[model samples]
Target: MSFKYRFAYYLVGFVLGSFFVAAVLTGKDTRCNYFPNARVLNDLRNKPFEYSKEASTVLAENWIDTTDIKNTLTYGDVDFDKSNIKFENGKIYIVEGKTVKNQAIELKVINYTSKAVLKEIKKK
Candidate 1:
């Protein structure tokens, strides 16, 4: 084989190898329990609420009602109830209902690093 032909063969082999490796990596279910969606009560738990610029503007315009806006965010595809969601900044807040008078219990995100409760507020 000529020098040019050998170089072409080597280049093609390298490209094919890279493609195969990429396919393998993407095909595997690398998602583990540590994934955000894998957590229990994820819908009702406070988490980061990522929204596009346009969506955020729309949410702010239409959903902004008083200091506390209900139904500002919806947990789509999640099994938890949607009425318990509230969006502020980039974080989502959720409240679990207890009884008629003490229903609104706030669930705020502790911090970005931990998935713990930062504060709990009961409706007065």
Candidate 2:
């Protein structure tokens, strides 16, 4: 088999495989949350959320709302160095990102099985 023939065959196979994968995945919620940050964020986003008193007060004062929090969780970066992932009750994750209004903020979230608790919200 010549080099050109083998290359052509490989290219054809690759294109077909990619097309098949895309067709299969279309209209499906195919997510790749393999990394720790993505995993934690997806888990928190799916569960019910509760806010502590201080967190609620901060949100109200800053004119932030659940939509802002949800946006943060969707696009935030987790500060693993500041997060405690081995807590007894639930893991603590520190998520930092911008609000809908482009205001930088940090969130302290406790990830429990049933729900995620927002412990604090601080504007940066």
Candidate 3:
């Protein structure tokens, strides 16, 4: 009933509640992608990716295989400044990401109602 006992009880309860919440959500797909790069990567990973004609051509020109392209898409960075504004022309998002063996690459992803298209690949 004393001040010290009340404080102790509150601290214990808070710690236990936090642990319970963490445990309950341990199996959930909870990701904290707050930065622009992380957010773009998350968007790409969560949605289905389609390649545009131009982008495909670029890939072929560079002899970049599908697996390498996939790796780039999966682990690319977003040059937010270089990227176009999203939804400016119907969900057009230009995300810049680097590949394992390459640098200064970008993907112009046009997100449609049901899918996202990699419209262009550029070497910057």
Report the alpha-carbon TM-score of model 3 versus the true structure: 0.67
Better of 1 and 3 by TM-score: 3
Give the C-alpha miss distance for residue 18 in model 1, angstroms: 2.2
Q: By summed lDDT, which 10 consecutive residues of candidate 2 come out lowest? A: 56-65
Best first by TM-score, ranked:
2, 3, 1
Residue 124, candidate 3: alpha-carbon lDDT: 71
Per-residue lDDT of model 2, residues 41-123, tens digit only? 99999999889998978877746878889899998999999996766689899999987889899999998889999999988
- On lDDT, the leading prediction is 2
Clashing pairs in 2: none
Residue 59 lDDT in model 2? 72
Mind giving the per-residue lDDT tens digits that candidate 3 earns over 81-118? 65656664446666665665666676777766567788
Q: Measured by TM-score, how close is model 2 to the native structure?
A: 0.75
- Tally clashing residue pairs in candidate 3: 1
Which pairs clash in the backbone of model 1?
none
Over the full model, what C-alpha lDDT does candidate 2 score relative to the true structure?
Answer: 0.90
How accurate locally, in lDDT, is each candidate? 0.40, 0.90, 0.73
